[model samples]
Target: MPTILTFGDSNTHGTQPMRSRSSDLPRHARRWPVILGEELGWDVVEEGLPGRTFAFPDAEMGPHMDGRIGLFIALESHGPIDALTLMLGTNDLKAQFGASPGEIAQAAGFHLDVALSDEMQDRHGGFEPFLILPPKPFAAGCLAEIYEGAAEKAQAVQDAIRAQADARDVAVFDANSVVSVSDIDGVHLDTSSHETLGRAVAEFIVAEIVEA
Candidate 1:
């Protein structure tokens, strides 16, 4: 079976709607990454962290939020992966970060560049880099205050990221076409969204990447 490294942020970490506790190891059969493995019968390594950002080091959230470190770790830690999937950047919209969608998208492209690097690809025999654009979050629920004005910025992420992914000639998928973020917290996902989004991503990969 082929293996895939799904490196992403909280949503990929299976964060449930309405944040209140710390994120633990992978769970939820309905979680998209879990569903991804089930639907495709492929080995899926889930690497997700709360508050992870592709652009900046968060002050309040801690320096660990720098996603580049985690991306390198995940690539080095896993072996013989056929693909690496990146789904992140929403956290960059934090009111504090003040990052524009274009900057966040560019930062995300950095990961694609890393995965496609000759050294990293050779380490795994070879691998394809895939980008999954995160669904835009609505500013509401407990996170409303922290994510103030995020929704407007979220509106432009898809196009911005698409432009970057296109420049790299990487495969990209828009998660919003299939599922939306949970209305509960706007930052996390509901079980139903996971089930739907997971299946959607699985189908996209199988049709576009695996069988293409």
Candidate 2:
């Protein structure tokens, strides 16, 4: 069976909506990756951490600094990965962490390309990357201080990814095109939004992966 891996934070983790407790189990059924896997009949691995990022001010944010270290470790432990879906950047835009959305997006994009390239060479022997650019947060006044120019930042990063995909002859899905920012929390994806994302990703893979 083909395998797909999702790498990201809380939203990607599918945290129980409006939960107050820390030990709440994720609603995996509501997460896009799980839905996509079901729709496509693929093995899905959910590696979405709650407080993870590509960059952080703290030295000990997680096992990976750029998010790729842990990714490498995960791949080594799990064997081979056929596809990778990354949905991050929300936490990296927090002002408390002193990371701007532009910087976060750019740096993350770069590292993502690097990781995909390495994974392709090492695992698949060479596979085009499949990327997903998540939409801007839906909440107002939440990231205003940190991601002051987030919309623009997102666009810039999306454009760069598109260009990179073009160069690498890969595929990409812009979540902003499918899920509206007005529909959910500035950061979280509601059930409806998750459904949309799942459908979109499933469609993309069905259309692109065979030849890719």
Candidate 3:
């Protein structure tokens, strides 16, 4: 079976939407990466971290949140995967970052730059770098205060991502077309959304990348 890597933040990490940080975690069977693997019959390597940012060093989460460095580490560690996925920027929406929508997309551009570079291509022996644009976050739950004024910015990111995909020539999938963030906390996926998103991503990859 071919290997595919899912790289991103909490949603990709299978964070179950909730009001507060708790011990509860989504089961592997429900996580999108697992679902994608099952649907595609491929080896899925998940490189997801909560609070991860596209290129920013998080305040509470510290510098480890920088995806540029994390992605390089993941790519080097996993090597020779058949393909890879990028889903990020939502964390950058945190009020702490004080980043604008365009800035967030610009960070994503930087990340794509690395992914599409000679080093990463050589590391993976060449594979499609797919971008998964997340749904607009609703700041109406426990994270409301943390994501204040984030809703509008989140919406803008979708367009920015699509534009970036066209400019970069990377295949892109809009998560909003399949699943929105759970209303419970407004930043993470519900169980059903996770399942739905997993299937959607599987179909998208097959049609857009594999069979294209």
Q: How do these models rank on TM-score, best leading? A: 3, 1, 2
RMSD of model 2, in Å?
3.6
Tell me each candidate's TM-score.
0.93, 0.77, 0.94
Evaluate model 2: give its TM-score.
Answer: 0.77
> Where is model 3 more than 4 Å wrong at Cα?
22-28
What residue pairs clash in candidate 3, if any at all?
none
Best model number under TM-score:
3
Go through the candidates in order and give the clash count of each: 0, 3, 0
lDDT of 2 at 122: 85
State the weakest 10-residue window (summed lDDT) of model 2: 16-25
Q: Across residues 1-212, which tens digit of lDDT does each residue of candidate 2 receive?
A: 88877777766777544322244555657788888888989898888876666666335455454565656665566636677777666666554556544566566566456656665458755534466777665334433454454554555555655565556555677888888543323556677878888888899888886664
Clashing pairs in 1: none
User: Candidate 3 — worst ten consecutive residues by lDDT sum?
Assistant: 20-29
Q: What is the Cα-based lDDT of residue 133 in candidate 3?
A: 93
Query: Residue-wise lDDT of candidate 3 within 1-212, one digit each (tens)?
Result: 78999999999988778767564755445799999999999999999898898878977778999998999899889869989999998888888888877887888888788889998898788888899998778787778888888887877876886787789999988898989887888888887888999999999999986466
In candidate 2, which residue ranges exceed 4 Å CA deviation? 16-28, 57-66, 97-102, 118-120, 124-128, 138-152, 181-184
lDDT of 1 by residue, 1-212 (tens): 99988988888988877654444534555788999899989999989887899968889878989998888888999888998789998898889988877788888788888999999989999998889989888788778887899988786877888888899888888998988887778888888989898898888888777465
- The candidates, ranked best first by lDDT, are 3, 1, 2
